[model samples]
Target chain A: MAATYVSYFGFVIKSVRGMFTGGPRYYAWLSFLVLLMAAGAAAYYRQAVLGLGVTGMTDQVSWGLYIANFTFLVGVAAAAVMMVIPGYLYHDKAVKGGVLLGEMVAIGAILMCLLFVMADLGRPDRMWHMIPPFGKFNFPVSMLAWDVLVLNGYLLLNLHVPGYLLYKRYRGEEPAKWLYLPFVYISIVWAISIHTVTAFLYTGLAGRPFWNAAILAPRFIASAFCAGPAFIVLVLEIVRGWTRFPMGDRLITFLRQVVLIAGLINIFLLISEIFTEFYAASAHVASARYLFFGLHGHDALVPWIWTSISLNVLALLALVSRRFEQRGLVVRNLPLAMLIVAIWIEKGMGLVFPGFIPTPLGEIVEYLPSANEVVVSAGIWGLGLFVMTVLIKHAVDIETGAVAKNN
Target chain B: MSGGSRIRPGDVKRRGFLKLLTALTAGAVTAPADAEAFDLDAFLQKHFHQMSDDEKRRTLQRLEQDYNDKYERDDFTVVADGPTPGVKFAYALNLSKCIGCRRCVHACVQENNQHRGREERGDQVEYIRVLEMEKGSLDLEKAVHDYDHEVPAEDKYYMPVQCHHCNAAPCVKACPVEATWQEPDGIVVVDYNWCIGCRYCAAACPYWARKFNWIEPRLPADEINPDTHYLGNRPRYKGVMEKCTFCINRVRKGLNPACHDICPTGSRKFGNLLDKDSVIRRIIDHKRIYILKEEVGTDPSFYYFFD
Candidate 1:
């Protein structure tokens, strides 16, 4: 038993070393990522020195880019379950290979989600205030606390299951089904939970009439289901480009269907929400009005939201049409990429920022991310991509390189 | 190699040494002043309900001392005083009496030690927002928060809004760390030191009563209110959430908040809700008063009434 623990410890170190020892192209990519991270860190340091005042956030718009990114990443993190459910629960073979990669994407995305949260804090040093045994967390009451718990819990489950599977494969041992299968099922439910809790973080707020809707969680799920799988498809295409791994065309085909169905549902949900907003023309319609057309001569968001919807509709068409995919990878990937970007903007600023427009008392204050905020956001994305690169490299190594590992 | 035990001291020591290095480096950045300033006891202070009277007093004293040292002010004290027995605090505002002079806004800032230099920075922070609304139209969506040309304009009515100190405060319920909560006397106060500054409270407030310190709040040394309440206004750091505590410092001493006292027309009335004889009590008993968004079931103690 002691030997087993020692062997496991050794295996983890070896896996890390193996990950670092890659081709020159791999090292160059890492260096580029490191450079971006350094730039972001510098920008964040300035923000820390000057205070959050450096960001475009006023008391009028208390949350900005950091939270927008955090919200999107939570959905991205939750999107892993789209593959985990069909691959494990229903025992689908076509998606089985993609599930590990999906989980890997989740692992990277959740870490980014957490980093974005830390970047958003005014007193990052006081983060210990949320930890147990001291900080009196208002659980079951404060949706923020629920968010903190579920995000961390979801990250843990993803990390554990992926780490367990990879380590077992590396050691040339068949992973015991009992040891990790229960956890895989747990991850499926937990993935839904993390995004739901994130949605609740917005919906439960009584102040923001824009997010105070019953459809928010459903909207979050539908968008996430589409956005998450869309993101994975993009990653899979990139990975297949870089390696000779036997990725079937059927996998991409399967995922585009998921994206099409989910994306249409998302658009449908959005239209329903818009109808409710404009139908009665209640006081709450103030935010929706600001987002869609213009409100009170302050229509800065008008062009951006319409442009977002157009891209979404365009991508939905391209995703569903066989003629579009027949245009080839570069051509097809454009719409897929647009679908991802469309969802990113829609789920992000389009959702979070409008809630503050024509402030609760009816004053119109606009928000745009300051240069420092942009730099910091870029830094977090660079870090997530860097992590994704390493995780994908390791998985590909297991599939195509020295390890003759199998499930 | 060791045949019996794989565990090794040198490996453990190397790991320990690296961890120590990281801690020292992190400590240097986070705690630049005396290690004593980041009081472990204060940093790890337990929940208010879990603390004894002595513990509470100690915590307050440590904070008072920390502030005094940081600000170079020797005569600053933070009181931990609670409400008078059986006292339930409430407020009433007479719309007919308010003149829209904005003296109450400035007075509240002075009393509460809100960001004094915000105006100089092309910014402003105030607990009380006075709105100029067009007469006979209650569409809050069209009200203007910043109306410069007004001694209560001919066609306009003024309604100054602040924390209602509701029985069920959304801000209090929104704090993930429980850093903000309602006191027994119906005052919602923030433990600024413990707030993680997520601004969840600010978002949760329907009235937009809470304010975030975008910059480290500037209360000039000369302008600093020596008499401070721990929950009301001590100097705040950048990022923590703060709101009107109904001028809790003065109210605890049977005094009116600065805003109440400064109102020239005597529009604001505040006192114990349980006291049948208090002015606020009489206003509530006889006047046709309305609280904002009562359908939300927040049950605010503050009331607005017309003549």
Candidate 2:
């Protein structure tokens, strides 16, 4: 028993070390990511010494790029379910192989989500306030507390299941049924919960009229279903081009179909939201108006919203059409790529910013994130990319049998 | 700026953190308030409710000493007090007499020891947001909160909004740590020492009544409101949320809030709501009063009426 445990422990240590020391390309990319993260850490240090006041947020526009990114990344993290539901629950052969990739993506996205939240916090040091038994956690009421629970929970599930599955695969053993399959099933439901709770975070706010709507949860879920799997497909296609990761075209195409249906539904929900706002013709629609058009001659977001709509339509058309796929690899992938960008824009500026446009007291204070805020945001994004790169490297190494001696 | 060498306990959260969490089992996350002139007692003080009376006294004494040393002063005292029994506070603003001079706004700033967003950086954080409304109607969409126009313009009426101290205070519920809560006297108070400064309460507040301290609250030592309450008008650190406490320091002591006392037009009237003889009770019984966004059902103590 002791000898078996020792061998397994030695293997894990060796694999982790091997993950760090790879080819020059791996080292160079990691170095680039580390440098970006360091720059971000330095910027965060300044922000920590100062306050969130250093950012462009004010009493009028309380949340900015950091929050916007957080909201978007939550959807991205939740998107892991698009694959998990089909793979684990439905037991579809086309998608089961790629479930680990979806989880790795979620792990990265959720990490970014947490980092953005810390960046936006005024006193991140006081973060322990959310944990129970020490600080009073306003749970079951505060949507944000719900968010804290689900985000971390989802991350843990992803981390555990992937690590366990990877270790089993490394040792050429099937995972125990009681151990990981139950979590995969739980994750399927938890993915929807994570995004739904995130939507509640905004909609629950009676103050922000822009976010206070019943359609918000469905809207968020639809967009997330589209954005998350679509991102996975984009990553898979790109990764396949460079290495032998063993993902099938059938799975990639199946994911595109999921993105297509969800994308169209997301568009329909948006149209319904826009119609409700413009048709009602009430003061409550002021935020929607500010988001779609300009409010009080402050139309900073006009182009951004239009660009999002344009990309959504274009990407939808490209996805539904088979002509692009018939042409070549680049042509076949264009729609999927466009759809990913479309969702990023829609979720980032299109969704989060407009809520604060016509401040609750009816003040029009235009908010554009300052340079420091931008640098801080980019730094977080770069950190997210770095996490993805390293995790994916490990995943590819395990799958391709480069790290496992027997395979 | 509040008088200081600006020498901060920048690493205050890190120092003596293990000691503070001696009561807590897990110590991964913590909120720290560090000062350059470290007093071990103040830095490691327990939560407000958890503190013993002796601890509270020591905390206040240490706070006073810390502020005096950090801000370079000798006369500073941080009082830890609470609401008077049998008193429920209420506010009534006479819209008919309001001229939109923004006096209450500036008055609250000076009285509350708020961060002076005085410079052109547009960082000034204030509790009161005076809305300029059309003379004949209240259209929030058209009302401007940042108008710099002269007071009492020919075609407009002014409405200054601040914390309503609602009976069903959403901000209190929205607080994850109960940092902000409704006291027995009906004023919503924030325990500055305990707040994590998440600002969720700010978003939950319908009136934008809550304000976040984006930077360390600075008041020129001379301008510091030395006559302060722990939950009201106390000098605050950067990164916490504060709001109109109805000046608990003064009102609990039989004195008027600074904004109420400074109003030139007598537009702002505040008194105990439960008192049958109080002016606010008379206004509610006899005057046609309106609560802002009453559809949301916050049941605020503050009422706007035209007398």
In candidate 1, stretches whose alpha carbon ends up further than 4 angstroms from where it belongs are A404-407, B1-42, B118-122
What lDDT would each prediction earn against the true structure?
0.81, 0.79
User: Candidate 2, residue A351: CA error in Å?
Assistant: 2.1
Worst 10 residues of 1 chain B by lDDT: B3-12
- Badly placed stretches (over 4 Å) of model 2 are A21-23, A326-329, A405-407, B1-45, B119-122
Candidate 1 docking class = acceptable
True-vs-predicted CA distance for residue A169, candidate 2, Å? 1.2
Predicted structure with the largest lDDT when compared to the true one: 1
Score candidate 1 by DockQ. Answer: 0.32
Q: How well is each residue in A260-295 modelled by candidate 1, as lDDT tens digits? A: 899999999999999999999988899989988888
Per-candidate TM-score against the hidden true structure:
0.93, 0.92
Model 1 error, position A114 (Å)? 0.9
Score chain B of candidate 1 by TM-score. Answer: 0.85
